[model samples]
Target chain A: MPNTFAVPDYFVSPTLLTRARTIAQEHASLAKRLATDYDVSAARRLGELQSTSTAVREYDEAHSALEELQSLLTSTDQELRELAEEDIQPTRDRIEQASAALKSSLVPVHPFAHLPCLVEIRPGAGGDEAAIFAGDLVRMYKGYCARVGLRSTQLKYDTADEPTHVQEAVLEVDSPGSYGMLRCEAGVHRVQRVPATESKGRTHTSAASVLVLPSIPTEGGGDMGEASFDDPKSDYYVDPKEVKLEVMRAGGAGGQHVNKTESAVRLTHLPTNIVVAMQDSRSQLANREKAWQLLRSRIAQLRREEREEEIAKLRRGAGAGKVGRENKVRTYNWGQQRVSDHRSGLDVRNLDNVMEGGEALERIMQSVRTWMAEQEVLSLVAEEENSQAQKK
Target chain B: MPRLAPSLLRQARAIDVLLPPLLPACRDLRSAENELRWLKDHAIKTGRQCGLAHSDASLKRLVARRARGEPIQYILGTEYFGDLELKCQPGVLIPRQETAASVTHLAQQLSKKRKGRPSDLHILDLCSGSGCIPLLFHHEFYAQPGNEHCKLHMVGADISVQALELARRNQKSQIAAQSKRVTAQTTSLAAMRFLHADVLLSEAANAIHAPIGVVEALQQLTNTRPTPAYEVLISNPPYISSQAFRTTTARSVRNFEPKLALVPDNPSSAPSALDGDVFYPRLLALADQLRTEIILFEVADIDQAQRVATLLARQSTWRTVEIWRDEPGATSDEADHVLLDGGESVPVRGAGNGRSVFAYRGAAAAWLQ
Candidate 1:
């Protein structure tokens, strides 16, 4: 590939540059509107676009600095050329940083990115071994949360007949901005290992699917603008009529007659057929509240993905060979003591470190996050390119 | 109760050693596992607070108590009612979720109708076991940002001294918890009180006639000059019929919970009263004497709710009577009206089997909207 001075390896493409500039313009207009009217949603949108605008300004300065360095590089004087040579590499680095920032800033932030998240893990394939792998994944995520200093609570942990096997589990990472951090972990995770239950030494393949959903704020919504449950237009809003609640009180009379400790609560979104059952807490009220919160998060995530899919369809081939929830995004090979992320194509030899949610797991997660950001940027560029083509 | 299968016990054993003990009370492997997990978590939490040895001892004691079919609320020492957690004792009736849901719905309605207006509102809770109804109502009502300026005088009355004591304790703790969260608004938690009163004798009692009447008790507790008229009268009195108590009531409830809070004490005295319908007539008479604007009576089921609603309607004091279900906020696809014994029909609200009978006077009919 021929190296171009204008478009470096980390530099933003023409389409992405225009996208960033447009976002900056939008931010400016929103700020002006907010100054006069003080609309809440508009102000929120302005806050969201703040980083992109800042990135655009930084990229422009870096571009100007590079142009100045380029002029100095073409100077006749040997001293000026040498001086420029020294600053040229650092200027290129600055450009690279600015462009990278600008590109990511152009990628739309997830609506629930600032909220805490729930990580749901369920066995996917290979029966009892898969259940055991699911248990491993649960511990791995829990360990990762601990190492990263994120407060995590096991919202629901159901165990199979086997002590070591996990029927299903939900781990709540109770910290803001966790959705942004752990959303990349949502997909099938395959493990190649010899089962403890296996009589023979033959290696077996098993899988566990991980789902990351934003945990809606219980009381004060914090910064969760339209995601408020009361807002009918909000993705979090499920019409009360659309949901069927089942309290696991034994058949017959309720109230004081039943001192039954079965405080399980199940909520099924009728339209979506998404059922969320919670029995963790002894209080039925608490369980119901938690069930609703989980149900809303799941519905919100589903709605967001559906909208994204529609947009992705419009910009087809932009996310070519992209790993979805159905695809195995990662694999932990116990035989080779390796952990690999398929999307980012990163492989590490330290299996124990990954299982411990150590530096190796962080590296893999970071790589996947970067890969996801790149995908978003590519699709954004494709969208802009198509719109521009239509203008022609 | 049906005997637990050996397989279920085996599964419970697989989950945890403590789980099999909870299987008796929990009645299933899943809930048993959940209870065990909660108990273990509670133990660990207590271990952090106190020593690990103390935690283990308490966990074992709690598991043993639960195995004997004691309510977890009693073992845990607290029960959540709406947003507030009330102290639960053995003799005091544990706050039921259906009651919480009804109270929450009523509070929401009252606050919504009030619309940030500062006004004196008095609520009378008859048979207020654990003082869950009034405290929950206060918590749910005052939680709305603008409602802090509103003057709330709530009195929870119960026949049992233990129930009254528990109710007062719940009120004090809740008031302390709420005072910390009180904004710039001057909210008074002092107005809420609990008193001893036999609501069964409410028919013959009046402010002047009987010193222990519901009205006189309200006056003594609230100390309002000229005796304030209650805006809302709410109760979750014992409504289960004696036969139903023997046949339909859960064994755990029969074993552990207080019968004083489950079945009305006497059914022979009132000629017109069925065993379960005994409390309604007395509560209605009390409501009429107090001139309470709204009344919410928690019933055992639809049949009981109908009986109460019919009784309230026959008095001619209430303008409209409605039946509410387990979840009063939930939407239902069923018919909005349930036909009474007479040709007249009453509007029904929410979902599940009818849980509460709601009736309001003409003055407070607007609040129902």
Candidate 2:
């Protein structure tokens, strides 16, 4: 693997660090209580003594209580540590961006904060090779998920016919900081090798694109102003006359009905010509509610796209063509056995090890943390300069 | 239950008389009464059975044993398992009621599904601790009053020689009981055999070899086959995780069990080994090779069950998997703890949620298609 980048070190704010230290101290106290008061020590002693029946029963109960307490403490400690580590920066540009946000009095928002992430992998220009590469990418992400204790659920997939494997697959991974870690996975991944189906020893190049979308929060409206919801501006509605509601027997992935009755409902929005389907509910009403939420998210996404276009048109006069353009995040060269992330300018030489899902990814996560810290510091400098100018 | 013997009842009354003045812990009247009754009966019965005369010394010793928390069954030297009396020892695991229920369920299913006479049946019991499973099957089907034509061929395998010996003794006792019941017209025949083999070990290397005694016994029972395969395979293997062992109460780990019978024999030294639950993968591999029609294995909990089911579903061999929990008797507190894949809680019918058993059947290609 390539050597990880070592950016300038930054310390978290003293207030946050102190809070984390207090939390850790509280956890130590709780652990001591669990070991002493819960009879964990007593249980170990009784096991040695081969004690009376009452003693044995007491020991079992005490041990279980201690185990539960320990698990709770570990989870709490992890949360505290993440919060403490939130104050670092490694780059001047990111620091300046943070300073600007603070100057504008805008609340800081994580790109994928508090939302389940949707990861999409699709074959690009490379035909069968791209599809096969996409399949490999899914496995890599799944392995990464296992390492991080994230819960991954396969949302949907389209398998290639006979000769090739998976053409496209989508997964929803739920965990703390999952989207922030996986956002770098977006863009095209390239693979070069002789295809197994190809008889000749000629090398072929294939490409697959990954799209990571933070799940739209249904409860918290995301930048959707009042105008988007008002009925006046080209209102779109599902025509009841043209719409059809179908209930069918639904089963798990293997396609056999787990239940005898047709409780699943599929709703087709007539005006936008969009179909929303849901089946994992016991009652029809529950299924309908799920379908409606999905429909709302779809409509919101369309409205957001239109709003972005209008904003871009207005920004054109400002002559800031480079503004708002996201970077080409990462590239994997299979033949050279190397992976390069343009954002951090870090290169990992062992592509196989990185693809196998190991510590190589942690290097990237640490760099992101450092970059975020740098952004904060630059913002602080900009604010200081602006205040001085105002005073003069 | 029968009332206590008169002499035993008198001894109990005496204990109750002395307890109030001596120990304040025994001040509770109902608790004192219960202690007295338990001590009196336990002393009288175990003393007589162990060939000790009905003397004051014997009574005191028996009472001391009871107070020390030794299981009553161990003091008695025998416990009833099905229709046979099994020799109970300190090292051997006790024959649980839930296991008995599992066996009964399997037998009922087999009887309902199978056609023709219940003869020519082949059964294999792995991890056959005291051979109670095969012996019970024999007693139920072969030694029954009217079931004469049933020809049962049973092979019980365990890794421990001591356990296998105890199993043999239990089998012999059952056979002796059968011969006594048989009249001049009917002839009693041997139907069960015991073997000592470590199923976890690879057969290529003789690292953990099957005991010669067990091998010979199996050959005799099978009439010359070195290895006897069966249609029905059942095992209650060690499924506890190493992490569970570390945090588990000493009552489970140190006092009541043997480590060899509880923990996996070997764990791969890999980073992912912590996540890899061992027994399921090995058991499934064995099932694939054996191609047994029916296989049942006990697991720790519902999470293990789901993971096992997932592993089996990935393979081509097994088609149907169903989880079976032991129904706790009427006296047990009713609480459901089994969790389904979709995060719904379902009732596990055993003593605890952890003791539930799972059953899987090999799927035919026609069924899949």
Q: DockQ numbers for every candidate?
A: 0.42, 0.01
**What is the CAPRI rating of model 1's predicted complex?**
acceptable
Q: Once superposed on the true structure, which residue ranges of model 2 sit more than 4 Å away at CA?
A: A1-392, B1-52, B116-118, B142-148, B179-189, B207-227, B249-253, B269-277, B328-356, B360-369
Candidate that would win on TM-score: 1
Per-residue accuracy of model 2 over A269-383 as CA lDDT, tens digit each: 7766768666543344556655654555455445545665664433333322211114335667766777776555678887776786667866754564444444434443444
lDDT of 1 by residue, A1-392 (tens): 12257555665777787778888999998888788898888988888889989998987887788788788888999999999899988888887888788887777776778889999999998999999999999999999999999999988887778777888899999899998999999999999989988899989998999999888888747578778878888888889889988866555688877865557789989999999898888767788888888888889888887877777664566754434478888999999999888889999999999998898999999998888888878887888888898999
Model 1 pairs whose backbones collide: none
Worst 10 residues of 1 chain A by lDDT: A1-10
**Candidate 2: clashing residue pairs, number:** 12
TM-score, candidate 1, first chain: 0.87
Model 1: how far is B238 from its true place, Å? Answer: 3.1
Interface RMSD for each of the candidates: 2.1, 25.7
